[model samples]
Target: MSQSFSLRTKSFLAGLVLPLLLGACESSVSVRGNFPDPEEVSSLEKGVHTRRDVADRLGSPSTLSTFQDQVWYYIGEKVEKTAFYDPVVLDRTVLIVKFSSDGMLEESHAYALEDGRVIDPVTRETPTEGQDLTIIQQLLGNLGKFNPGGNK
Candidate 1:
């Protein structure tokens, strides 16, 4: 084979091997998150089960309502991704289970990121005191408005 033909063959083989090599080099991901099912939470009957039983079946409640001792909140968040390259949270499922004071299941709600866009806790519009600056003032903000040329 000609040198050019051999080079082309090697290039083509390398192209095929590139993805496989990268894929092999990737770190193995252990799915570190688990989210409970809303329906499974609903199956739990608060009136029927005691605290011990509740804990045994549903694992542990995430938070207990401060004001309401009876209200037990079981919150779970799970984020799944396709690849480690970007590490995107491709799928997010949240299950919030509320149990009554008597140890009965009161409410079971689930939320999926697929249902809506991610919400930012912080607001983009920040409140500033005093008057708003104009284009020139805002542009030359640090320079200040005092100019010797403008003096009478």
Candidate 2:
């Protein structure tokens, strides 16, 4: 009888603990964009390496300059999330490569996660002209105003 009781207690404890362990272990990681190696980037020479050479060494850029085609940007970021919380940025890197009009590498710059500044997003809500109605008010608001389809 004691053996059976011990087995039942163990099984009950296992069933309760298993789900909590699994729920607490939930997490996700996301990586975006290609990050170039420092050694490879150093190999590129200003006013010497062409666009093709840069592309071959660093891979295609994540984006080109918004206002000009002479600049290229390589962006990389890693984000992580646990359970139901918002994702947090774990790492971020931005490499800017500028080319001369003749397509030679002019300059390169790298920005790390610590080099960035945080900007709070705009959260002000725009107010519109309307009466805030409750569920019952909304449901009954148009009940008597509906005109049955006779063209009047």
Candidate 3:
């Protein structure tokens, strides 16, 4: 009788713990952006391929240069996330395709995750030419400013 109870308890504990362990090990993978195939990217030739041909092959770029339309960026990333944990980037690819003024491919470069750099943004606030008022002061300041009459 004692041995049977011990075995039953062990099985119950395993049934509860096994699923938790599996759940913790499970991670969801998310792929975002148009990650072009290696064959498609290799098909593009510098100075030979035009923007229309490249666009037709690889589709529209993820984003164009902020100031100009000459540079195109095809950015892609794969992220894995587990329950209650920050997402981890498994892979990142940035394909930069530069075009000349005449719309021909000038140069192309592919950057992987290892070639990327992390930039910390500046947090300093810019001084503005205005007086900062508190909520209470703002409410009290407007109390007497209201003109009840229809006249301005």
* Candidate that scores best on TM-score: 2
Candidate 2, residues 1-152, lDDT tens digits: the string is 99999999999999999999998868889899978999999889998899999999999999998988799999999999898788999999999999999999999999999999999999999999989899999999879787798667
1-152: candidate 3 lDDT, tens digit per residue: 99999999999999999999998879999999979888999989989999998999989999999998899999999999998889999999999999999999999999999998999999999999978999998889899686889586
Which residue pairs in model 3 clash with each other?
A: none
| Model 2, C-alpha of 102: deviation from truth (Å) | 2.5
Error of 2 at 118 (Å): 0.9
Each model's C-alpha lDDT? Answer: 0.64, 0.93, 0.94
Q: Ten-residue segment with the worst summed lDDT in candidate 3?
A: 143-152
Q: Which pairs, if any, clash in model 2? A: none
**Ranked by lDDT, top first:** 3, 2, 1
lDDT of 1 at 107: 62
Q: RMSD of model 1, in Å?
A: 7.5
Candidate closer to the true structure by TM-score (higher is better), 1 or 2: 2
